[model samples]
Target: MDPEDGSGWADVSDRSHRIDDEMDRIVERLRDLAHTQRRFQDLLDAVMSVGRDLELPVVLRRVITTAMGLVDARYGALGVLS
Candidate 1:
């Protein structure tokens, strides 16, 4: 008997199983991405700490890099206000 028949047993189809598997894979990928993102944030924080501790010219560059990371932007700039 065809599973699609209205009067047959409530049978799940292979398409549904495939979709569930795809969804599971997507969820797992997102979890891994989140973990990587957290690690990047942690490292950025540590760099900022170093910049603060050293109080050197390179600190400004680190600040710009941190700001760019926050905005998901590839580039950043800093200017003195008049």
Candidate 2:
């Protein structure tokens, strides 16, 4: 088939569309991975912060604050059961 033939053009167009679709999927996966990494890092940091304090009250306060921040909650509390 001639390079300038319409048949060749259709093949090129199809390949181009496939490449674009694949690239879009790759970009979406990368975004999701990045989001997951950030969430993991945040949780790790929160855990580390709570662990750094050996005092019970301090640890509980840090845990509560971290939990509230993670969930975007306006308020949080830790209730101890006797």
Best by TM-score: 2
Candidate 1 weakest ten by summed lDDT: 6-15
Q: How much lDDT does each candidate structure score?
A: 0.75, 0.92
> What is the C-alpha lDDT profile of model 2 across 1-82, one tens digit per residue?
4676578888888999999999999999999999889988989999889989899998999999999987889999999999
Show where candidate 2 strays beyond 4 Å.
Answer: 1-4
Candidate 1 residue spans exceeding 4 A from truth: 1-12, 55-82
8-28 in candidate 1: lDDT tens per residue? 343345667888999999999
What TM-score would every model get versus the actual structure? 0.52, 0.83
